[model samples]
Target: GAGVSQSPSNKVTEKGKDVELRCDPISGHTALYWYRQRLGQGLEFLIYFQGNSAPDKSGLPSDRFSAERTGESVSTLTIQRTQQEDSAVYLCASSRDSYTGELFFGEGSRLTVL
Candidate 1:
């Protein structure tokens, strides 16, 4: 089965532009997550979607960030009015269950806001 998949692997935009990053989780996986990594920093949890439950959104940095998962499979993370501070690598991961300690990650979508 395919692991997590992310699109537009690299993006460059001017400040204030909006960007959308997409992710497709592995088949049969019920737990999906979104994380962000800025340059040399470690992964930052942004959001998590499990089955049909309400998404856990506490990790989003600000109002400019949002995400949604549909059919418990594919998800998209959106950034409004992108800023230089928003420049980072957005990563997606999925696990068999929400409580599991292991998550398979995608090759991140790198965003650069000029």
Candidate 2:
């Protein structure tokens, strides 16, 4: 895809199970970010990866949540031992980062834990 694409736009999983969501960012972008939105709340930054720099995982909710990105390209988010409260929309965005703050976002991967 030319823009960011996320798999399984909607997912349903039982609590205590695990799920993996995927994302493909635009070509040539140097910055990629992951965020989680809980219901009506604003998007919360989860992690970010750029070039050869180290990833920032400070926003991860707990050990149950983790993500990875390969050089501003494809990325995956894994939620382990998911809980009902883990349900939310996972968003991915990428940008060229040439002194701009704009980030292109995917439709988002919606997960519902039952």
Candidate 3:
């Protein structure tokens, strides 16, 4: 993919169900981030992975949310026991490095929990 690619552009799941969103970043990008945006709200940082260093999971809303990345290629965000409040857009962004400040974002996965 030429840019950051996300899978399942839209997802509708029942409350308590689990969902997984995927992201494929641009080649050579070393920083990947996951964020959530509620309806009519701004993006909330969820997690950040920079190269082989420990992933910064500080922003995760709860223990039910988790993410993983393989090297610098792909990343997946998993939300377990979803709730109505979890219905939002899951966004993925990548940068050459955390210091660059410029990011490439994916189209995002819209999660609808009903």
Candidate 2, residues 1-114, lDDT tens digits: the string is 788899879999999999999988888888888899999999999988785353578999999988877765788899999999889999988888735788999999999999
Backbone clash tally (model 1): 0
- Off by more than 4 A, model 2: none
Judged by lDDT against the true structure, how good is candidate 1?
Answer: 0.90
Candidate 3 Cα deviation (angstroms), residue 60: 0.4
Score each candidate by Cα lDDT.
0.90, 0.87, 0.92
On TM-score, the candidate that comes out on top is: 3
Task: Supply every candidate's count of residue pairs whose N, Cα or C atoms clash at under 3 angstroms.
Answer: 0, 0, 0
Off by over 4 Å in 3: none
RMSD each, Å? 1.2, 1.5, 1.0
Can you write out model 1's per-residue Cα lDDT over 21-49, one digit (the tens) per residue?
99999999999989999899999999888
Q: What is the overall TM-score of model 2 with all chains considered together?
A: 0.92
lDDT of 2 at 102: 88
Question: Which predicted model would earn the best lDDT?
Answer: 3
User: Order the candidates by TM-score, highest first — what do you get?
Assistant: 3, 1, 2
| Candidate 1 TM-score to native | 0.94
- Please identify which of the two predictions, 2 or 3, would achieve the higher lDDT against the true structure: 3
